[model samples]
Target: MISVVLLGSGNVGTHFFKAIEKAENVRVAQWFSRQIDSIKGYKNKTAITDNLSELMEADLYILAVSDDAIATLSSALPFENRLVVHTSGSVNVHDLDKKNKRGVLYPLQTFSKGAEMDFKNVPICIETLDKKSYPILKEVATSLGSPTKRVNSNQRRVLHLSAVFVNNFTNQLYRIGHEITESEAAEFDLLKPLIMETAKKIQTLSPYMAQTGPAKRHDKKTIEKHLDLLKNPEHKAIYKLLTKSIQNTHGR
Candidate 1:
């Protein structure tokens, strides 16, 4: 079995650790975290450690820490010239330096604790400075049910930024929708069908063609009504700007 150490227990780390538990030929040899109480459940089979020395024996160390702590934590690890990988999207693999056989194992999707994800469907973005380590990482990724893709550092950065807009921004829009409906005591569940349909359409329709609403048709009366309904200044500004943008794009 290929022994591995995971160095964080946050959202991504927790999801990844659980997913890896189901794969063969791999085992979580050790786990390290500052807050040991949070991960007490994993202390049974996996050696849990707050000290860096316990990480010495593992074949590979996966730093699931934040991008800001990568350099500091890497420098503190007891061993040198061992294989090390990080799971980060915005941070480049090169940031880990040449001290270890550095690589990246970025999952392109958002991870939330307690929410199950299909490892098979999530694309695994893999990168490595050492060519020999690439296949090993690929095999590990495949065994865990992910579709692997080789992405360079620059491409990974762009992909991550795009993910924020598509996932984060869209979720914020949903939250706004919920808030608006709740204020007037309307059921937010009413929007579920529309939400699912909008997402389904994107699979076949170009977003531009699938786009609808008063903004696309230049229904000035509806736009004015929406503006009047919006109580938050920021939300109103956003709605007005987006409407104007959509109108301009469609030549309305």
Candidate 2:
């Protein structure tokens, strides 16, 4: 059995704990949070501590902390030569203090508190400074039923940047759509199907092939109408920028 000490209590950490708790081959030997109350609810399931010195022996130390904290936390670990991995896409594996064996097990997915996540579909990007640590990280990812991909720090950074475009930027566009619908007293729910269909199309069709609507068609009249309808300058600016981007992409 693979035993792990999970150090962090935020969204990624919480979800990791829940998934690990259910995995038969792996178990969380301990959970650490700066403030004990953040993980107090799990006290009944595993050892919880706020002190680094109190951390127990485990097969892996998974630091699911914020990107900024990974280095500091790993440096502060009271032991060395142990397998230590962080769940960060952009942070380099070498960022962890050399006191311990360092690696990364970045789950390439958006995480939010109180949201359900199915690890089986989450692609875990794994990287390790030491060759031997690769299989160990893969085993932990497998324990969560997640598919693993070997990614260098640079590839992971590119994936993370692309994710920001597809997930974060797309969500902001949806918010703008919601605002636009509200301005006309229209139901935003009306656009839900379109959103789902757009997502579904990209599954079987390349995004370039799936492109549609005024910008892709170069319907200048419709584009101008959209700009005129957008009362907010920020929204208009975004619309114009995206329209230009789409037009440029299609050789307009």
**lDDT for every model?**
0.87, 0.93
Per-residue CA lDDT of candidate 1, range 157-220, in tens? 9999999988999999899889999889999999999999999999999888998999998898
lDDT for predicted candidate 2 compared with the true structure: 0.93
Q: Please tell me which predicted candidate would have the highest TM-score against the true structure.
A: 2
lDDT of 2 by residue, 123-156 (tens): 9999988999998789889989999999998999
Native-to-model Cα distance after best TM-score fit, residue 76 in candidate 2, in Å:
0.5
Off by over 4 Å in 2: none
TM-score for candidate 1, please give it: 0.94
